[model samples]
Target: MAYVINDDCIACGSCLDECPTEAIAEGDIYTIDADACTDCGTCADVCPTDAIHPA
Candidate 1:
């Protein structure tokens, strides 16, 4: 399972650095690249808005 950024995302960059695979990318709301995401949930732990979730 990969993690995804939800609409609740505030466009913060916290998750970007937390992603070990560098899967999170800047966007209208940050996005997690499913192919690169490893279900580590690092981004979720670092998310200020709790917007990162399993997809």
Candidate 2:
């Protein structure tokens, strides 16, 4: 499974740099590219809003 960014995302850009595979994309709520996500959970670790979870 891949990590998904939920509506709780604040677009703080915290997860973007943390993703080892560069799966995250900037947007109103931010999005994780499931195809590129490596399921490393690094993004979730740094998310201030705890918006990232397994999908």
In order, how many clashes per candidate? 0, 0
lDDT of 2 at 8: 98
Best by lDDT: 2
RMSD of each: 0.7, 0.5
lDDT (tens digit, per residue) of candidate 1 on 1-55: 8988889999978887777889888988888889988999888998889998888
Q: Per-residue lDDT for 28-47 in model 2, tens only?
A: 99998989998999999999
Ten contiguous residues with the weakest lDDT in model 2: 14-23
Candidate 1 wrongly placed segments (more than 4 Å): none
For candidate 1, the 10 contiguous residues with the lowest summed lDDT are 12-21
Positional deviation of 51 in candidate 2, in angstroms?
A: 0.3
User: Any idea what lDDT model 1 has?
Assistant: 0.87
